[model samples]
Target chain A: MTESVITVEHGAVAYDDRPVLRDVSVRITPGEVVAVLGANGSGKSTLVRAILGLVPLNAGRVTLFGTPQRRFRQWWRIGYVPQRLGAGSGVPATVAEVVASGRLARRGVLRPAGGADRRAVAEALQAVGLTERAGDPVVTLSGGQQQRTLIARALAGQPELLVLDEPTAGVDSASQDAFAEALRGFVAGGRTVLLVAHELGPLAPLITRAVVVHEGTIAHDGAVPEPAGHHATPGHEHVHPHAPDESSGLWGS
Target chain B: MSLFQYDFMIRALVGALVIGLTAPALGIYLVQRRMSLIGDGVGHIALTGVGIGLLLDRSPVLMAVLVSAVAAVAIELIRERGRTPGDVALALMFYGGIAGGVMLVGLSGSRSNANLMAYLFGSLTTTSPQDLTVIVVLAVLVLGTMLVLRPALFAISHDEEYARVSGLPVRALNLLLAVTTAVTVTISMRAVGLLLVSALMVVPVATAQLFSRGFLATMLAAMGIGLVAAGSGVWLAGTIDTALGATIVILAIGIFLVVAVGAAARRALVRRRAVPAGTAAAVEPCDVVLEPAPTSPTPALDLDGPDHAAVPR
Candidate 1:
């Protein structure tokens, strides 16, 4: 009977009259680690974006903690780590500075950063095992390190629910292990997590449930789907039948 | 000391000092967002405001602020819509602005091209007490807003989508940034001139970036660079009898080049010292030499074979 952390009922989304997600319904309760899985272009990203109100939904509704997405103002309660991309903009920002920005939601615009904010930033950096590189420019970090910095930024907010899109898509194995460790710590705190990923590698064991998005709708909403046959082997090459075959000739097989 | 004796010189220096502090304060965010030339675009539009004021016999600074604010809002709306690429839209505004300013100035019968030139190239020597007052007020406003909202501004400028999701008012802040940029353009028009204002806004930050590793450091260094450039540019202009705006901008650019070259040379020196050590370590333990065995004959497969010769002959 407790309120769900995230709720989407018949959610639909379109870009330029082209539908990306349709008839997508999902509900995530507190303390659940849910992974939205699908091949590329399956609209898994769009679904999460819609839930975060990053993208407009064409139809249906989304609610965070039972409050409608539009009216929901308690953003400090939710931390979002967007799809992994370069953390640095044109301007140079250190890892700690970037992570400290996450505290803006908790610390209003006018007030200065208090001791609590600094502590949160420090803790977030330590959680991601990036305390050593906290002073380095984000651009100087490796791709995986930058991704960790982003996760650290999200964690700095100390939110109850964390939403991430592909936290380990192109990360190195070491950073992936660090990320998985961080997620384990986050889950141990009895928080909730929802992420969009193509293939959960290190994160596979952390996911309690999986919601498979196929062509914009939920294909499966149950226990994590086990890899079949060869895919079950450790270090086996992960393949998606629905993904475009890059090895096929340019004209396609 | 002698330079500070004259009232006009004192006003000019004071005006430059304010411009020094404010231009780069606002410029850092603009640079972060990759909108370095936004100041120039707003400046051009403000020129049209300057023209309107000349025609109406009202305060040119006030008119410039009003007009540029509207233009800035329009530009922000266009950017938000993303229908037109931001640079293309800005180019259009730039041309439209300068064109409108020229035409309006011509229509204003009493005002001559010389009067407009003062705003164009900046005649800091002629900075009246009233102009100084306006500059200080606007500078305070710009600095105050930047100080108060820096974190939010930095958040949006760094990653707009993340900021939006974080419940920061991205749209409103963007508009405020545009307006703030407009105010900066007008405030700087009397000291650096409208046309070259962007140089002052951009170059100092560019110089600061060479040595600074973080946003706050860059911003602080840029402000310091700007202060030095502005203060010294005025004194140098007075001493050399050069155009104030050009002198200030050139000074800023000069500082940027020095720092850039210094940073590059320092990096090269570090690499030079580290390279030999790294190569020596790599060579000491991993060196492997292989000799071709006497039993391996036919040159490891015959490069002159018919199969190889037939491929492209």
Candidate 2:
């Protein structure tokens, strides 16, 4: 049996006396690209965060690679790309330097980046097709390029599982198509991916399963719905008119 | 040349140089975190420590560090409790410290107002050998902590949630920042005085942020700015016979204004030149895909770190 890379059994999460996710359970096994689809404030981000131990699980349990979430220590195994932050939240960093941060867990602190670290950073940059822009400051890049820089950072760790939160949001279609192409290469290596996106878009073909989150619970879990036409040519003008009422109300046109 | 005629003058210069290097070295973290006023708050708290020292006939700076450290820890704990904004806690401490120090100074049995004033506006020409030794050792220790924990510190400062999920020790690192800020403020009190020390820490770093694109580059530029500001300010103070601490701070601010105004003028010129050609670097980005890079051994599970096991109290 393929080992489950992530498992959240009856997990519940709350923030300041308000429940965000309740009785949420999910299991991501090796090599499956599972997209968590949901409307805004439907607890999708919270679910991923709980599974990764970003938010404290108030009830039930979470386990990473079979170890209890609290005891789970192999951080390098899981690479994560968070949503874009405010422009002011960041110190100006180059694409290479920010991507190199992914290797921090593997190499440890104090020692300078070595040859292996350099090679991984180089490969990650190449994978994202940002090899040419590696020397530019991250802020100088467009939002899509900055998103690619973050993905490259996660890829630099060479993690077994990658968790991304709304990576394609506000990005241009060309960058989206490129990201999809790079993801194909990553999945070819038997890596598992837990993706949180509003619409699969360019990534529709790569998703092996879809888990829809609604109002803090798992609403649907199975094959990708056939009618969304997300597999069409990439363009920001593409709209998901057929998305369920809940998600359409939140993000779809 | 005559400035070197007095050993006291030489000592003051050394103290200013040392404090200048370390204040902004640590200040980069505070500024990135948007906790710019933290140093100011802690400096106020240290004054109470100075007052306590005067009452007990002890080294006021030593007493000030102890008080500031405790206040730093308290600020962190209050922040962790999450009752209000961090600034509220800081403002509370800032005012409480100033008020407490004033009260303590009045209550001090010996009434050594001169010593108290020395810490308020540093006696630049009064640095002793012992003071120099303490400043040097503490400065190295603070800078070393920053260097050794660079990645972890950067990670947490950038995104607390992401760092926590990555198994980085978030709480311990926060506490370490607190300790360092307290120490930085304490050591700097002797060079620029408590009131002006934060300027030494902030202005040079802010100046560097104007154009530097990466963390290390900004840090290096800030250090250079600080060195020039402090070193030149000391000599300028000696040359012109001005107040030493105030002159150093004014020099740092002067450098900031030059950079800020130059950057603004350059931006205006670039817009005029580039707008017609559509050659601006402002293109929208695209989506990212993660499809490959597997087949290696499973990542090691060891989670231990420099301060992982000990939970911050």
Candidate 3:
């Protein structure tokens, strides 16, 4: 069997002593596209946080490529795109400045970004279909463009693994389509991806496997059986009418 | 030439430069974090410390620095302990510090209320060589910390969680910011006085941000702007014979507004020009097709789409 790129054994997480994720065990092999699904506050983001060492595991071990979460190294090999990238977060940084930040791990301190860094940044932007908007103020971009910029930031790292928490959350339908297309390209390039999402219906077809997180435990983990009645074949698109909208509620229409 | 040649004028210029460079260097982080009031809080806390030292016949500035540093740590610890935001904690500590210093001064009943006024309001004309030396050393230390902590600063600035995920020492960096703020505040107190020091720290960085992109350039621009404001403010104070710190801060604000408006106009002009050059550099030629293999590696998971056919694992 292929060695697991991420190993979580009986992991538990909490905030202020109230448990969020508990005794959860999961193993993700290298190159697998895993989707973590759950309702609101199902501890999905918390689990991702635990795996990335952003949240302390109360009871179990989280190892990324054999290294324990606390000791996880090769930072340049991992990239993250959060749910929201606020443009005016007081940093007053432009899109390029924000994207260049993805190179911090590789650049270390005081060492300036060189020629290769610029190329990677450009390519990442191009991959996200954001080459035209590269110089725009991150704050000035529409919601979709900002999200794409965030994804480009992760891609700039050229990470072996990319973790996204709700990549399409709060994004427009068209932007979501574009984001999905870009992600498909990423996986095609031999990289791995793990994502935590609220509504899995719209993105179900693209997911290789679904791990349902309920009450901090894996409620379901298996290859997603083709959704009952939806047949996705060559030259056909899977349509889920519940395209998420701001007022349509979290689960969607 | 005489302004540069005179001893007192030289001291004022050098003093302004040192404080200008140091306060805003630390202020960049403060402004980014929405902790602009920290300089004010630290200054007040340092005053209480200085009062304590004066009561004990010690170097007031030294006492102030030590006290403020400890207070900075305390503020951080408090912030971490409770769920209160950093700015809220800073305001509380700021008021608490001012009250404590006032009480201490009332109890001690020291001579020369005017001297206290001078320190509180800033008087660059009285800077001693020793004061300049201390400011220089402290400025170097602050700059050194800024350089060493650039990554952490960037992390804290954007996507703090991702920064933590990337294995940045976040807590350590936070503490470093606290200490640096305290030190910078203490040094700036002599130049702008305790009350107006925060204005000096915040205005330069804010003004610099008008024209710059990227973190390093912003800081450089902030330092350059700060120097101009400080020098100009000191000269204005000399001409008008008003409070030096107040003059400096007002001048800094004026400069900030002018730069901000000009920069905004320039950006609008550029955007208008780019309307026609839309195809020039906006979009690249290589983005025609974007399709990666389904059988890619593990870490390349895309959060979008239903194309998960690759990866035998």
lDDT by residue (tens digit), candidate 3, B1-313: 3456668778888888878877788888788877677788788888787678767777777888898999988887776565548657777777888777766765667874765676577777888888888988998999878867665686665666766655566677778788888888888878888888899889998887666645666777788778888888778887777777888899889998887676656556555654454444336554431232233222122221111121111
Tell me each candidate's i-RMS in Å.
6.2, 5.4, 4.7
Worst 10 residues of 1 chain A by lDDT: A229-238
For model 1, chain A alone compared with the true chain A gives a TM-score of: 0.90
lDDT of 1 by residue, A113-213 (tens): 99999999999999999998887678778778999999999999999999999888778789999999999999999999999887788898899999888
The numbered model that scores best in TM-score is: 1
Off by over 4 Å in 1: A86-88, A229-253, B83-88, B279-283, B287-313
Report lDDT per candidate. 0.86, 0.80, 0.75
Encode model 2's per-residue lDDT on B1-313: one tens digit a residue: 8887888888888888878888888888888777777898899999999889888889987898899999988887787666558757678789999888878887885655776677887786887899888888998999888877877777777666666766777898899899889998998898888898789888888988777767777677787888889898889999999878899999999999988887766556544554443322223222211111121111112111111111111
Candidate 3 off by > 4 Å: A16-18, A86-88, A200-206, A225-253, B1-5, B85-92, B105-112, B147-151, B210-217, B259-313
Highest lDDT: which candidate?
1
Model 2 bad stretches (over 4 Å): A86-90, A228-253, B81-85, B109-112, B268-313
lDDT of 3: 0.75
Q: Which model, 1 or 2, shows the larger DockQ?
A: 1
Model 3: residue A111 alpha-carbon error in angstroms: 3.6
Predicted complex 2: CAPRI docking category: acceptable
lDDT of 2 at A45: 89
lDDT of candidate 1 over B136-192, digit per residue (tens): 998999999997898899999999888888898899999999999999999899998
